[model samples]
Target: MVDADQTFVIVGGGLAGAKAAETLRAEGFTGRVILICDERDHPYERPPLSKGYLLGKEERESVFVHEPAWYAAHDIELHLGQTVDAIDRSAKTVRFGDDGTAVRYDKLLLATGAEPRRLDIPGTDLAGVHHLRRLAHAERLKHVLTNLGRDNGHLVIAGAGWIGLEVAAAAREYGAEVTVVHSGPTPLHSVLGPELGQLFAELHREHGVRFHFGARLTEITGQDGMVLAARTDDGEEHPAHDVLAAIGAAPRTHLAEAAGLEIADPAHGGGIVVDERLRTSDPDIHAAGDVVSFPHALFDTRLRVEHWANALNGGPAAARAMLGHDVTYDRVPYFFSDQYDLGMEYSGWAPPGSYDQVVIRGDAGKREFVAFWVKENRVLAGMNVNVWNVTDTIQRLIRGRARVNTEHLADPHIPLEDLAP
Candidate 1:
């Protein structure tokens, strides 16, 4: 166990880093705890950036993890808008990128989160093209969307992932025409499979959003450094006064790489490699959040999850492991999204091609269904769409690993709890 006099340093002031500081204090770690963030604002929930905040339903202050006074009250040092350039593992010090300011630590936690991925296409740096990752990005997009009502222009989204669909919904709510271009045949096809993905595609279609499926954004053409249209590989161009490229995100792993940590293989997106306890190769330096690729107890291969719940839960697990406590950082990965009038909650890990078949219990056409991904009658993952408060039961069925009856599983009359072992 670390002594009370030792100092703990946490990099990246996102939800993961904030939660780690909270966990350290709650776990009775009296040592010095410092959180360094690159953003000017305090740590905040990012999920709201795409949904409530972008829609102006939530205030900016409410997105922050805590008030500015809360950090000082807890005796936790807050280093805002600081970039950590490098980590000297042998000396246990993290140096700043700009002024080379260095701070030594007894234990370091790397919660450096992911950044939005950008395409190498033309006109990416144009004025009207944007990507949503930070609060600043969302605020900028919000301003553009506010002007769309007067401009009478359309928003062209480059990807059909969770962020793309959610933003499309919000933009449509604000009276801007929206068009989505995706490489897949249906929205979220890689994750939810065609059946469920089509349901989402249909949901957006019903809400007056256009989709160009099986297409790639070849270039984003602009006039005078402002986005004008997004052209696709199929020789089709869609008018877009504003463009949001919600392609995906990549883990911010430059610091970890420079520190000589064991990064995951290139095939696995090259995240920092960590054990089940979230410990990096260097015992004193632990990694959590989207930047980590750790072995899952329930899955065969190493997995790296980028979702709100993973960051919310993984931070505490990493903190417990840092205190010389024996811990296995294992939890059923969960994620949720709200698009238009539909809301969904998915639990457990089922990568693409992992599950053989999907069994649905309510009407998918009506947009109220509980879908279970099964292989050999063992539930791999489950999703409840427009259905409330059954995630616990769904997760249990996946963990129990009992043989399930497909007929009963598809019967809406059967309670999900009864399917569990």
Candidate 2:
């Protein structure tokens, strides 16, 4: 049992940090817990920021991780608007805020999340340019989108990744003219590859969204500190009132790096390296969530997942490890996305060149199908689009590692459970 004198400090007021604090208490740890957040608001999930909240389908209160009273009732020392600038490893303390209040910890958990990658082009400092990563940015974007809808303004979004496509759908729903600029031929090319990425391209085109393929945003021209237009490398200029840089995010590892913790190389996705138990270079210092690069036994690789489910499960796993429990953080990677009427849940990892064949079950034309990435007759990963109640069976196939008949895998009539066994 942890003594009452022991203190556990978790940096970064995000879903992972908040959930870690909750797990400590649930597991009967009576040690002092200090959760510090840079933002003034409490910890909350980030998915809704780009999806429902941005679309106005969800309310402001729904985005929060817990009720305001839950933290105090549970005796969690919640510090908001205080950023940890440095970590004194030898002294075992962290100093923060304007006053430089120092807090000592027996164990330190780094859950500092990622920051959005900004466009390096000109006119990025313009008033009408926007990027969505935090609640505050979403709140400002919500107002910008609302005004654009009411005034019949056009919005040009850079990058055709998940964030870009989701925001495109939301903007279209709000009656704003939407155009996406991407260097790839289709959306989500880095994740879904060209085969499935083309499906999303068609989906958006049907919704009246324009796509500028094989080019990137070179410049954003503006007048009087407001956006006027976006110029592409292909020499095409798109007229716009507002611009959303829906580019991807980079992991926030400066604090971890400054503390002399070993960081993963760019090929490994650039994060703080952690073992299967989520232990960093310093045994007392652990890292989890998006900031961590953990070794996955199943995939035989070190993966740094920036998905919602990773944070939801990684936090509790790290908490248990901190309590000296036998923990192996080997949960299958899972993530879901909602665009228009389509909903998808992707399980396992299947990057390009990692899989040999992609078999489809059900009707792709109708937007209801299960696509499997197979390598040498074994299922590496599977994605269910507009198809429900098969994630369990799909994960079973991945974990089971049994050879599946390629013919049966593509047959909609054959049940997924039967093939795994």
Candidate 3:
């Protein structure tokens, strides 16, 4: 167990790091708490970057997890705009690159998060090209969209993932002509399945966004250091005043690797490997958020979730474990997304081809529905789209792992509570 005088250091200032700091204080640990983040701003949430904040529906202040004064009030030391260049495991210190300041820690928690993947195509370094992972990126993209106008604005998006789709929606709302080119057969097909992915594709098309599925982006053509067009594998080119490469993000694991921590193999999704308690190979250190790939106690599979809920919940769980608590971080994975009129909440582990069938309730065509993926008569995962007030029940069905009547599950009249075991 950690003593009161020991210094507890947290790396990464997103939702996970902030929550870990809050947990350390709430758990009555009076240790010296210090949070180190590379970003200049205080801890903030990332979802709104592509949704409300991008659409100008939310103010900049609301994006922060907590105001700047909260850290001071909570007696936490803040190290903003600093990069941890190396972890001196033998010396038990972290070295910062900028000022060469080394901070000692009795216990360390890593919530390094993930970084947006960049395309290697030509003209990627040109102006008017963006990726929506950081606050600064969103700010610049919003400014470009606001000034670009509808008449000649063409936004080319590479990747049909959630970020790509959400940005497409926001661009359309701003009256920009948008085009998405993805290698997948449909948007979000790998996760939501083709049926539901097609629904989202149709949604975007109806809103005046063009999608080219099974297409490869050959290059991003530009002139005078400004984006002009993007060419595809078929030699077809689309107008592109701006481009968003939302291919996906990779977990930040260089620090862990330098410290000789266990990292999962590329064949196994390639992330920092940890146990159920979110403890890395070194017991003195712990990792959470998108950076750590920990074994799932319920499913017997390792998972590295990049969703907001995981960071919000996993950070606290790791904090508890750092304080010498035997923690089994076994919460079913959950995530949600907002695009256009669709709001979706999904829970449980839905591995590829794991479910035998997907049962639906409500009207999918109307975009108000609940879909449950079932394997061996048990609910593996469930997603509620454009529907409100039933996330708790959906989580219960997944956690309980009980067989339910398909007819009852498919009936809107039959309450979800009645379907529970």
Candidate 4:
């Protein structure tokens, strides 16, 4: 039986932290559960912030991970708008807020996620410049979109990653003129690489979105505390009623670093280092979500995934591990995105240099296809675009780690099931 007198503290109030608390209860751990969030709002998921919620299709209430009453009903102590300043490892306590109030814990979990990387450019503080990372940010952006929809305002977006592209799609739907500025050759260059990135670029172009590749904002020109235009390093100027900085996000790891936990190096994407069980260097403390960089034996490297699926699954996995259960979180990395009329689900990890060639199984022009990244005829990763119900077989092929026939993979009639066996 679990210790009912024990206290478990979870820091960060997002999907990961919320799910961890729920798992603790579900696993029959009758202990005091304290969940601390820097934001005043209850724990919520982040995907909707940039997608449905921002598009006005999803209500604000739907973004939350659970109903407001669920925490109290489950006997969880939920602290809101409270930032943990430090972790006192020696005393086994977490100090928070201006007064440095301490909360002692027998075991602790750090689910601190990531923060949007700010652009170091002039006029960023202007009224029309924004960043979308939280519920509040989306709220402001939604209002801006409504007004832009009515006024036909021009929105200049910096970066062409998922956030930038998603917001661009939303802006276009709102009847706003959208221009994306990206430093790479095409949109999603870091993730999809050039080939698939070009496909996205074409998709956005067909939706009337303009692309300014090989450029980044050198300055944001404004008048009367309102954005007017953005000037790029390539000496091109684009008119802008509003500007969005969606460059990227960095893991929030100050507390973990100050507490002297093992941190992954910057080159490998810095994050709090954890084992396969999501256990940190300190045996009493574990970590999950974007803040966690753990060993993936399957990939033969350490990875820190910031996608929604990571937090959705990692939290419960960590919670079970904290409860002294045998847990090996080797789930293959997965993420999906919706843009315009096209939707895609990608499984496994394949960066630009990691795979030798890409094989296509369907019509790329129709935007209905399955693409696989192969290295020496072994499937490293697969993505299904505007295709459905093959995630299971695709994941099995990845986990199989055996050589696959490129002809079978490229043939649409050859079922994905056949490739696995």
lDDT of 1 by residue, 1-421 (tens): 6788899999999999999999999899999999999988999989999999999999999899888898999989999999998899999999974788898999999999999999789888899989999999999999888888567779999999999999999998888999999999899887888868888888889989999999989999988898889999999999999889899899898999988899998687668999998999999999999999999867777888889998999888998888888889878889998887788999987756888889999988888989999989999899999999999999889888899999999998887788887
Kindly report which residue pairs in candidate 1 clash with one another: none
**Candidates' TM-scores?**
0.98, 0.98, 0.98, 0.99
Question: Candidate 2 on 1-421: residue-level lDDT in tens?
Answer: 6688899999988999999999999999998999999999999999999899998889999999999999999999999999998999999999899999999999999999889899999989999999988999999988888888888899999999888888888888888889999998789887787889999999999999999999989999999898999999989999999999988888999999999999999787989999999999999898989999999988889899998988999998898898889989998999999999899999999888888899999999999999998998888889999999999999999998898899999999987789985
lDDT of 3 at 134: 91
TM-score of 4: 0.99
Whole-model lDDT, model 4: 0.93
Tens-digit lDDT track of model 3 for 1-421: 5677899999999999999999999998998998999999889999999999999999999999998999999999999998898888888898874879998999899999999988988888889789989999999989877865556589999999989999999998898889999999999887888767888999999999999889888899899999999999988899999999999889999999989999998666678899988989998899999898989866778888888999999999999998887789988888888988889998887756878888999999999999998888899888999888898998889888888988889999999988875
Candidate 1 residues lying further than 4 Å off, grouped into runs, are none
RMSD from true fold, candidate 3:
1.2
CA shift of 236, model 4, Å: 0.7
Q: Indicate the worst ten consecutive residues by lDDT in candidate 2.
A: 412-421
| Reference-based TM-score, model 2 | 0.98
